[model samples]
Target: MNCWKTINISRDYGTLRLIMFSSSTVLLSFLFYYLVMSTIVQTTEFTQFGFVTVVLSLFGLVLTHKLLHCLPIWLFGGRAKIKISTRKLLFPLMDIKLREPLSRNVYLLALFSPLVFITTAGAVGSIMWPQFLPYFSILTSINFGLAFYDLVYASHLMKAPKQCYIEDHDEGFHILIKQAV
Candidate 1:
């Protein structure tokens, strides 16, 4: 599919639903990991150098995922920008917007970029270094949980009767419904 016109991003209806969906998914994943996965561990340590490195690298991976989405916008002739700030003790937000509505395929591809990168890399790393499965699994779960929301929102946009409008915001990017006129 293709996007034919410019669209405004909104924090309206569909977005709220996606936020709820994303939140619930993350919460469930965290709970499951804590209650189930954590208990399965046969070994424990307060801190380990290799694990710390893996943790930092995974954080880098997440940032890379965001950059992956942003960088492509410019390459594809769409303008993109980001603003970062924290609202509360735990509320850290990274907002991004593309000035142009990318093709549906591009948008969809971008949505899955993190998942593909994290999961694929983690799978390979885990196989090559079996001892790192715990770290890889933990990081992969986090990225997967987060990407769930974006996938839902992308799906909603793809099904929208109107074109999607994506614009920059002070906090998070807004996805707007295009007017018929």
Candidate 2:
């Protein structure tokens, strides 16, 4: 096997740029989600959570998003190591290290599962519980921001050869191709 490409999005795209993009995504998605939900629900009363509750809820959402990413991999019989740590002594970070290479399709599925699942849940929750639409919109927008990196990785994987495999490493992901004998 030979590595056809190595994609380190943070290194290639610059951390600042990625952060800016993610921030923009969060703001824009929140606006769009709230607008759509309000139009659909026609709710005059919106429930608000306390600051502590909101913070805890956001943390839970982040953990749920990470778990969703790992779910597809586990279902496909893939192994991954998950490490949880704190960044800046306050923010939590979860790093998922793949144990082996996966087919492009499988890797793509893993990448996208969180975004699809979380977004769908948020949408449905907003519809079913119209009074909590604001909370749902916030969580969904935050998840969208978190998913920006996955979207970037998936975009790169989409351009690789159909038979290629993806391996996650410290720097980023590697696209590998089998060499003909």
Residue 172 deviation, candidate 1, in Å? Answer: 7.8
Please report the candidate that would top lDDT against the real structure. Answer: 2
For 1-181, candidate 2 gives per-residue lDDT tens digits of 3435544433367889999999999999999999988998878888888999999999899889888888999999999867887877766689898899899999999889989999999999999999999899999999999999889888888888888888877777778876554
Highest TM-score model number: 2
Q: What are the RMSD figures for all models against the true structure? A: 5.9, 2.2
User: Whole-model Cα lDDT per candidate?
Assistant: 0.62, 0.87
lDDT (10s digit) by residue, model 1, range 27-104: 676556545544554434433347678868766766776876676566667777765769775755676766655555
Report the Cα lDDT for candidate 1: 0.62
Name model 1 segments beyond 4 Å from true: 1-58, 88-91, 160-181
Clash number for each model: 9, 0
